[model samples]
Target: MTYFKVLFFTLCFLAFTTHAKEQPLKLDKHLSVFQPYLGSWQADFDVAPGTKPVQDVGLWERALNGKAIRTKHSINEGEYGGESMIFYDSKKDSLVFYYFTTAGFYTKGTIKVLSPTQFVAYEEVTGSKEGITKVKSTSDLKDGKLVVSTSYLKKGEWTKPESRIYTRSNQAVKFK
Candidate 1:
């Protein structure tokens, strides 16, 4: 074939091959979410009408030497703060969180990837039958603000819904 035609075909082939090799970005590592949520946070939330008062809780390091983040959760004017669970799930691309408050209640849940910076954790039931408990929690960053929304689900549908807004205050702590 002509030299010009051969060169054109080669260029086209190279362009297609190069573009095909480029893949979309995904949550490949835990650090992608951990680096942003490692520090302190105050969550404003509610339980039931005659339940405990609405609160803003302070979160901080409860321990230094560990693989997990040990946080102390405090109220606006209360001395007692809830200590909670903080860790990342590498395989699931999610974050695990837990808390037991002064009202003597235990809660645990997760935040899962819906996108790179956005996540929502829905209720999950584990066990064959007879014995099971529900989980309710979710969070995401939107419009330069981190918004957390929660709900109770039965058989994978929302039963009760609530939401809270949080802003990233401190610079994210980083480590290599």
Candidate 2:
């Protein structure tokens, strides 16, 4: 009986180790969808609906051995800048992002990939001048241009979306 028990435990341990070895920690294949956005871009931010667009630049780079993508963006010539870390969460089966801004604000959001070239990110906002609580941002890439529309939730209703269009930068954008 003792010998049989020892054999059974050894087999179980070996089986567990083998299974663990087969599964390495890595990003999901769906991460390839972000490949097209892996460069530098320049865009303008609409201060309000149909208002003048403030110049901004965005840089996206692969980081952490391809496990995540990091974004650094400068708005209005460094009036405000932010960094975002985007990664796939295997446990949640979704893409997650954490954003920190120079204005002492932070947002956590999840990206729902609508397709390879389109995605929607819903964010919970805090520490803004208007006290915005929630925001929904939709992004689509077309003809080598990236367009993003963001809507804020106010009084249980989604407000008009502010849109921004970004074009690929042939030259690097420098921020102050």
Candidate 3:
């Protein structure tokens, strides 16, 4: 009787273990346009006319079994941070994303892929007290660097565009 019980337990364990293994995740073909940006990066941007440049660290990775892309970025080592998730919207037939920031604002956007290494994003900001309601950005990856230029619509007026250049880095993103 004891031997039979031990054998039964062993069989159950093996069956559970075999079923627990998961298949490898494969990135959706629609996300191939973001391949160049799927890694850690660092950039420095001038926040003001004479102030020193602030460093921003970012990480991008495949998420949700490769059905979506996730990005997290921090500025000045945690002064501000945001996380974004990009996914394909089958009904809309486009790539859509949402960004949640530590600054108490969030954005919903759509992406337009131009080439293998270039894309444009249009965002609508919500819950911002600064009256920034719209944002448009273009990202281009070339020669081991990522360049992003952005413009903001605040108080119903368009602001001057600013650009940032990012390179591959080993830094990690942090939030305070």
Candidate 4:
């Protein structure tokens, strides 16, 4: 009787494992838009003439079985940094983005695809020290460089935009 019980359990476990392995994985097709950002990138923003440009590094990778893209970024050698999750919402037919920073600020937004390598994310600010009410973040890839611009809306007026250009890095970026 003990031998029979052990054989029965072993067969059940094998059957369950085989069934699980036979299941196929489904990934979102919209996630392909972020394929260009799937590697390491480095950017140096021109702040002023005499001062050195602010340096930032970004690492983007696929997560959640390719249903989402996650970005890990750092500014000025980890002086400040943030991570963001970007996914497509089939129900809304829009791209969704959620960003959280080490500085204790978080923002949610919806993105609109402008081209195969260009997109714009619109966000509403709540507790940001920058005091911006609405934010438009546009990202474009040109000549192997990623160009990103952030435009702020303050009191219903659009302010001067901040932009950055990031180059593809040969080495991979490590995320903590």
Instruction: Return the top candidate by TM-score.
Output: 3
* lDDT of each candidate versus the true structure: 0.57, 0.84, 0.93, 0.83
Each model's backbone clash number: 0, 0, 0, 0
Give per-residue CA lDDT, model 4, range 81-152, as digits (tens): 889899988898988988887777678899998999898999876667766678898999889899999988
Better candidate number, 2 or 4, judged by lDDT: 2
Q: How does candidate 3 fare on TM-score?
A: 0.83
**Model 3 clashing-pair count:** 0
lDDT of 2 by residue, 131-166 (tens): 677889999999999999989976568899988899
Worst 10 residues of 1 by lDDT: 167-176
Native-structure RMSD, model 1: 15.8
Candidate 1: where are CA atoms >4 Å away?
1-31, 43-55, 60-66, 79-81, 88-97, 122-133, 153-158, 168-176
Can you write out model 1's per-residue Cα lDDT over 1-176, one digit (the tens) per residue? 69999999999999999999986333325434534454566655656788776555554452333335565555554544556665676676567767655544555767666776677764444441423256566667667566776665555555666688765444222211
- List the candidates ranked by lDDT, beginning with the highest: 3, 2, 4, 1
Q: Runs in model 3 with CA error above 4 Å? A: 1-25, 47-52
Tell me the TM-score of each prediction against the true structure. 0.50, 0.75, 0.83, 0.76
